[model samples]
Target chain A: MHHRLDALLPLAGAILFVMLWWLLALSGVIDPVLMPAPQDAAVALWKGFADGTLTHDFWQTVWRTVLSFVIATAIGVPLGIALGSSSRVYAAVEFVIDFFRSTPASALFPMFLVIFGVGEKTKIAVAAFGAALVILFNVAYGVMNAKKTRQAAAHVMGAGRLRIMVDVTLWESLPQTFVGMRSGISLALVIVIVAEMFIGSTDGLGQRVINAQMVFDMPLMYAAIFAAGALGYGLNLLFLVIERRFVHWGGK
Target chain B: MTSHSPGSPHITIRGLTKAFAGVPLYDGFNLDFARGRITSIFGPNGCGKSTLINMIAGLMPMDGGQVLFDGKTLRETVIGYVFQNYRDALFPWKRAIDNIAYPLVRAGMDRAAIDARVDELVTSFDIGFDLKRYPYELSGGQQQLVSIMRALAPRPEVLFLDEPFSALDYEMTLSMRDKLQEVFHATGVTMILVSHDLEEAVYLADHVLMLTRRPTRIAEVIDFGAPRPRTSATLSEPGFVRAKAHALDVFQREVRRAP
Candidate 1:
């Protein structure tokens, strides 16, 4: 009975959150124009999908997010492994990696725009750049921290350096690599959405939300915000599922 | 294959030197491991019992040393090592069977031959648990058994074990000890075990190697030639009791001799 109740507890919290939002909307303490009723947002969501505008915007954002993530992963995993293999090499460039990682992707938008000239290339490049650094740091960490005993076991078994890396080090780094990939994908999505809002994007949830607010289409703006929220939650969940399936021995 | 009879030196260590931050742990250390006999290394705390074995096994780098297995370098001779932490020793990602097969794979043996060798090890171990299960799925004792299997997979001439049972409970330790003895008698593989527990050290060893504190030297090398498959009854035997007491007296003396 306790287990069943625990499962339903999350549902209860969601319902309570919706109730609080509805109550605040009815109270009218804030202007109705800024805060639409919950039903108005839901109705706008349905109508936007039915009219196919939201569907187009949703796919556009997904395409950009996935493209950048793929690019980031391609560059990150190998580079991370190469850097992490030797302690001396990683130490030399550690500060440079840390500095770029700490700086916000948004702050570098104008520089990217200067390079790529204010188009889709610029947005994707910026998102991929932010995501790649996150992935590189995590993958390198995983490789560097690969268990010493495990490596020694392989070496004692007559394995050469190349074989040890492929057989043991690669497998050892997987759990951490997955951690990096998940965070990288999430960061890519956030940057993609923010880029769409300011980089002159014509279609995407970010562009739709901003355009709705400019014309004071309150219900549409709320709907776009909710869509973005759902997308973020869904992507995180997807990566988590993938991580469990592949890295089954991860935390063990 | 060299010599199954005990007392023949299978490995020679000469002038082994190692230090931690300039406080010498071993200097000009020399030792011999008898062919086809169990040797348990015992010493005072921080005396480098594990360190000595690791250096001989080529797991740790020695500042200066020469180690030879039948006059062959580490790369030329096949060796197996069972680490104290079985959880860290066994590859969790691989199934129990695959973990046992890993050494064979590393040796570049064909797939068919690898399967045959792994099957032989499985039967010898009398394993009833599913070999397809991952390491984490098994009990602690079972995991350690898998580690032992993997070590023996390459059919190494000399097997090095670093406190193999320290993590296990008393009950598990007893059965693992029996299994090790069974394997030793059946195959006559040279076994080197490093243990802190004196009784455990003497129980499984044909020779117990006692060492002094750092800048370590051999305190004594006592040989207990009691017969194979020693059981709980062996613990109370006169020879076993005398050996244990002798080892304890030497151990206590060395502990007090510390600066």
Candidate 2:
């Protein structure tokens, strides 16, 4: 009972914040145009679905994030695993990796626009660049954290470098890689939306938000924000499902 | 194949030496393991017992000296290791059968031969209940049992066990020891076991090799003349008690005398 109550405490604060927002809007302390009422936000969500505007934007954001995630994983996982498995490679390249990781991925958005134009390609490139650092660091961590005993056992059992990776290193590093991908997905969503707002031609959830704000459509803008949150949450759920299936024997 | 007489040694170590960080663990260590017999190595903590076993198994580099099998080096023989801690030894992501088949697979054996060996082992070891279960699902003792079977499955000429039964309960340890003896007898494979427990050494080994503390060298070799099919009854034999007492005395004396 206490465990459950402790879990509910965070939700209680969220509920209180919503109640305050409703009261502020009703009392005119906050203008309805600036912050739509709860009922108004609901009506906007229903209308978005009824008219198919939300579906189009959501799918656009989904494809961009998916494409970025795939590209980042393809390039980052192997490179990270290779470097992290060797102390020499890690020492040589760690400084450069750290430099890129600390620098803001969005700071290069203008350069991306110049190189690829204001198209889906530009948005995806930005998202991939934004997500790659997380994937790389996580894969490195996963490889480095492989148990010494397992590695020794594999070598003594006559496993060469390739066989070691195939039989031992890959599966051992999977759980951590999945966890890193989970965090990377969150960053992917944010980057996808931000990229669209900054350098997009048409049709993305972020573009929808920017478009609504351009015309002073308060309810529509709020609807887009809620949809972004839902998309991020749904992606997180999908990652969890994948992790549970592949890493069923983890933690034991 | 080099043949030994009924009482000749199968494994020989001469002037074995190893050092870590400029500190010597073994300086001119020497011992011999008789053919077709279980030799228990007894020593106190940090006496390089595991290090010695590793050198014998070719798992670690040696600073000096030679380890011979059947009067020839490991170049002419096969060696297997049953690691001390099963929790960290077995591959957690692999099923029991897969783990047993790993070495054979790496050896480039035929698929049919590998499958047959895997089936034979899983059945003989009675790990069928967990043929598909990952290492994480098995208990520590069960994992150790599986590791032992896996090590033996490759049919190596000499098997080195480093505290293999230390993690098991008393009952499980006794039962597993019996099983191991059966396997050893059936295959006629030479066995070397490094252990800390005097009772265990007395129970399983035909000869117990005792070592001194760090910079360890062979202190003495105690021979247990107890017959095969060792049991709790063997523990009460006169030679068994004498061997255990002599081995313990050497260990306690050396551990105190060193530092």
Candidate 3:
């Protein structure tokens, strides 16, 4: 009973949040034009999905984000492991990785635009660059800090260095790699949305949100914002599930 | 059984030298370990007991040394090692059974043969817990038991255990001790154990190798001939008591002595 109650707490909080927003909408302290009723926003979301216009935008954002994340993981995981495995190499290149990781992804926009000429490839390339750095640093640290005892155990068991790296070091870095991938996708989604909003784009949740704002379609704008939010939350949830499945013994 | 005479030692360490931050921990150290005997290393704190074994096991580099296993370098020898931190030593990503098979996998054994060997170990060890579960899912004793299984999987000629039961509870420690003794009896592999507990040092040892303070030297090597299968009852036996008392005496003298 206690566990069941604990599980329901989050649902209760969500309902309460919506109810508070509902009450505020009805209270008229703020302009109704600015803060539409929660019901209106819900109906708008339901209608947009029903009419199939918002579906295109939602899927577009999903595709770009997924592609960027895929590219980032491909580049980051192997590169990170290589850098992390060698102390000399890691020391030589640590500063560069840290510098880019600290810089905002948005700040690289003009540079990316110049290199890729303000099109589809530019958005994804920038997002992948940002996410890759996040993942690379995480995977590198993960490999570097893998438990010494486990490696020693493998060594004493008569494993060669290459075998130890493949058999032990790679598996040991898995949890952290998942962590990187999870956060990488979220950052990718953020970058993809920002790019869609600013750069010339025909469709996407970001484009829909900005388009609705210009046309004074508050309901559509709010609905698109909620869709983007759901996408982010869903992506995080997906990666979390994957992480648990792969690294079941993580943090145990 | 292999012949274990002083004239023909199984392992010979020549001029083993190691320094920590320019302070010598072991300098020009030479020692011999008899084959097919359980040797327990007991020493003062920071006396480099684990360090010495690590160097011999080729897990750590020595400043200078030649460690020969019956006239071969460490690379030419097959050995097993169990660590005190069994949690860190275990691969959490693999199932317990797979972890045991890991060494064999590295040895390039075929899957069918590996399965046969792993199954043999599971039966011989009389393991009750499910080996399908990962190491983190099991209790501490079970994890250490897995480590021991993994170590023995390769059929190593020598086994090194560094305080393998120090992290376990008293009940688990007793059971693990019995298990280790059974393994020793069955294999007669040249076994070396490093321990801080004097009673454990005496109880499990054919010879207790006592060491001095830093820049450690052999204080003494006391032979313990009390018959096994040693149990809790043996802990109070006259021979066990005598060995323990002697080891403790040497330990005190060395711990207080100037390095």
Which candidate wins on DockQ?
1
> What is each candidate's DockQ, to 2 decimals?
0.84, 0.61, 0.81
In candidate 2, what are the lDDT values of residues B33-145, reduced to their tens digit?
88878888888788888888888877788999998887777756766788888878788777877888888888889999999988887776655366677887887778888
Q: List candidate 3 segments past 4 Å from native.
A: A1-5, B1-8
* Model 3 residue A181 CA deviation in Å: 0.7
Which digits, one per residue and each the tens of the lDDT, describe model 3 over residues B1-259?
Answer: 3355632589889999999999999899999998888899999999999999999999889999899898888888999999999999998888999999999998999999999999999998999999999899999999999999999999997899999999999999999999999998887788999998888989999889998898888899999988889999999989888888888888899877876
Q: TM-score of model 1 relative to the true fold?
A: 0.98
TM-score of chain B of each: 0.98, 0.92, 0.97
- Top candidate (lDDT): 1
Model 2 Cα displacement at A216 (Å)? Answer: 2.7
Order the candidates by lDDT, highest first. Answer: 1, 3, 2
lDDT string for model 2 (A1-252, tens) is 999899899899978977887888899878778888877887898899789988889898999899999988887798879887998898898989889877787898889889998788888887787688888888888888887677767776777778887888887889889987888778888889998787845889999999999998989998999899999999999999999988987766
DockQ of 1: 0.84
Model 2 scores a TM of 0.91
Chain A TM-score (model 3)? 0.97
TM-score of each: 0.98, 0.91, 0.97
Better of 2 and 3 by DockQ: 3
lDDT of 2 at A188: 82
Span of ten consecutive residues with least summed lDDT in model 1 chain A: A152-161
Recovered native contacts in candidate 2, as a fraction?
0.55
How well docked is model 3, in DockQ terms? 0.81
